[model samples]
Target: MTKLIGYARVSTKAQDADRQIQDLLAAGVRRDDLYTDHGLSGALAKRPALDKALTALHPGDTLVITTLDRLGRSTQKMLELAEELRDRNIGLRVLNLGGGDVDTKTPMGAMVFTVMAALAQMELEIKRERINDSVTKRRATGGDLGGRRPTFTESQIRTASKLIKAGEPATQVAKDMGMSHATLYRRIKKLP
Candidate 1:
């Protein structure tokens, strides 16, 4: 019998997959039929759970995702995957599609997916351009490249290092400097 297998992913451990899992379950996918890869970016080619889910698929089965983006960030990769699924006689269902979910078991769904991929590719290109422009603007203004500014200045770090070398505890020095001991050591390690 054909089955609906769900795949879920999160780019970081800080993010939760509960929402996707719930959506898949609500779509009638069994809990045992769901596979997930946590703390894994869609850009990565090798995801253990994704691999297993693909392997579990067979002819007449449908691979379901909460959204198309869960398949991957690359339009080309997503298209290639759909092609492979098509070749194997397996269908694809994206639950959170724009108007309605796209299930590639139908010709109209296949066509809609092609258009969606083209739009996704364009969006990716636009995002890249925006990032490049932002970096260029920041560089032109000599602004530090987008990261949190160091809480401890170079001078504070230098003094904290000296204090540690002069028999003071690292924890005490860090506490006095209003930062964590690990932060203090990380800064000291970066010092020349």
Candidate 2:
């Protein structure tokens, strides 16, 4: 017979695991079918409850969570796990994904799951690019002094610029100066 297995996680001791347990119960998971990782981070390599929950699933069983993030914060890892579950002929159900539930057993739910993963990946890349741009601007304006100091002093920059202009390889200059090739090129570009 097919069974429904539920897993819940809360990252901190202050957070209430009962809320997720209640949600899972309301979704029709039996009390004994629920597994929880209280005060444990999803990033942790070992989650004994989650390990047990997964091991209990069979080919026709379904794994349920309140949110996709309950499984993991990493979109890539969640996608991989969802794919693996599908391959094993097990189902995955997220109770609240974008104001609704997603069950891999349904065609529309599967499509939404894939689309959401793509959207998540795009958001992460956009956030990374924005952060990189912000740091670059701060560094250029000398406003972010918290980062590592520039390895090359003014005199070294001048020498590096002249060497590069005189046909010395930027990589060799970077190696000799204890900086990166990209840094050497950027410093060369800054010369008047």
Candidate 3:
């Protein structure tokens, strides 16, 4: 008997996997045939549910996912997974794929999968290049590459220093200046 297995993932607990589950069930996959990974990053390799699903797969079985990105964010990883499935004579079905079925039994399906994998890889590379270029431009312009600016202003640091010079306790000065003790101490260390 042919079996169909479904895989779904969500990166955070805040995201509900109910929709994916419903879609897979609606697609005729049984509840027992579904595997889910929640609050797991796509970059992680050691997902327990994913491993169990792979282990449960037999030759001629189909592994279904709502989207290819749900399988992995890295194109290399996705290709590796496809190769593994092919070696086992298993088929892959990505619901988000446009007008093509990627079953291993057909040469055309394999070609389509290969082309999709290559396109995903190219997309990731282009995004990385754009990000690197943006970072380089920002660095050249003296813009903070860090995600956020520091909380304390130069005037606040000067005030903290003056308070320290007036024989005020660091903790008290920090409280009075509405800053944390660690912040005040760091500013004090920067003074001559």
Error of 1 at 70 (Å): 1.0
Residue pairs that clash (backbone atoms under 3 angstroms), model 2: none
Q: Estimate each model's TM-score.
A: 0.82, 0.62, 0.69
lDDT score, candidate 2, position 59: 97
Q: Candidate 3, residues 11-57: lDDT per residue as tens digits?
A: 99999899889977877779999999999988898888889999989
In model 1, what is the error at residue 111, expressed in angstroms? Answer: 0.7
lDDT of 2 by residue, 68-123 (tens): 76787567777888888999899999888899889998889888988886676677
Task: Name the weakest run of 10 consecutive residues (lDDT summed) in model 2.
Answer: 144-153
Clash count list over all predictions? 0, 0, 0
Candidate 3 regions with alpha-carbon error over 4 angstroms: 12-18, 73-76, 99-101, 144-192
Q: Candidate 1, residues 90-186: lDDT per residue as tens digits? A: 9999898896899998999998887787787788789999999999999999977868777767998999999999999999989988888998899
Between the candidate structures 1 and 2, which one is better when assessed by TM-score? 1
Candidate 1: how large is its RMSD? 3.9
Q: Pick the lDDT winner.
A: 1
RMSD of 2: 11.8
lDDT of 3 at 163: 79
